[model samples]
Target: MSAEDATQGLGIDALLERERAKLDRLTPARAAAAVELQGALLVDIRYAALRERDGLIPGALVVERNELEWRMDPTGDHRAAETTDHDRLVVVVCNEGYASSLAARSLHALGLHRATDVIGGFQAWAAAGLPVTGAPNAPDGRA
Candidate 1:
């Protein structure tokens, strides 16, 4: 079926809900712990504009949304060094968590079964007092 036909009646909200249902989404704090304690790879999928404007999560792999599958597929030639195994946990983060759900679902389709997203994305991470760089009054107390 055509892409339009497959999504004939489903709006973005419905599609996001369906995608999220397949994931065990993580909150900002939990996501941070997963990275710090469990070796989970936190991937920032927000575009360059957003990253520049809102700052970034320190140590999170900055992968463009369009390049995610290529960079994240463990067996792909272009895969990031961190994409070493299918069993590795990958936590996706977007601007506000919406796109991350869909991105995580796509990772699942690529056999990354442990892929999931941050519940409120980078905004939540920053709000939860997690580390961020380049943001106003950053975690390090930098302006």
Candidate 2:
């Protein structure tokens, strides 16, 4: 935690609250429906090990959390082909959902007004009976 901050030197929880406050996060079921009906782009930002161990959402784009902003920034040289639209509804996913909120906020900074994160992440999706493929070391999802 940093000292002398405006937030009274609060830690990650406070940071998470601030980030989430800026978003309209979606539940897993709604997130899946958003992709199918609202044209939302679901992004999975988990690392290789966790993803391989748990599995992946069927159609979510695999982009590591660290490079998210660059890949989704339309003006960036390495931006993903699917992220060209500033109005695209981006739904970022992390292992449990915390990091995805931060990722979505970064996307908003790049003029992506429709950016948001999954409420409970991949686990929630699986719990909600959403489609997922690949298993631990299954050699199916992106490495």
- Supply candidate 2's per-residue lDDT for 5: 68
- lDDT to native, each model: 0.91, 0.86
Give the range where candidate 2 is weakest over 10 consecutive residues by summed lDDT.
134-143
Residue 54, model 1, lDDT: 78
Clashes of each: 0, 0
The lDDT leader among the candidates is: 1
Candidate 2, residue 83: the lDDT equals 87
Q: Cα deviation of 6 in candidate 1 (Å)?
A: 4.7
Alpha-carbon RMSD, candidate 1: 2.8
For model 1, what is the error of residue 135's alpha carbon versus the real structure, in angstroms, after optimal superposition? 1.7
**Positional deviation of 20 in candidate 2, in angstroms?**
0.7
Any runs in candidate 2 off by more than 4 Å, and if so which? 1-4, 136-143
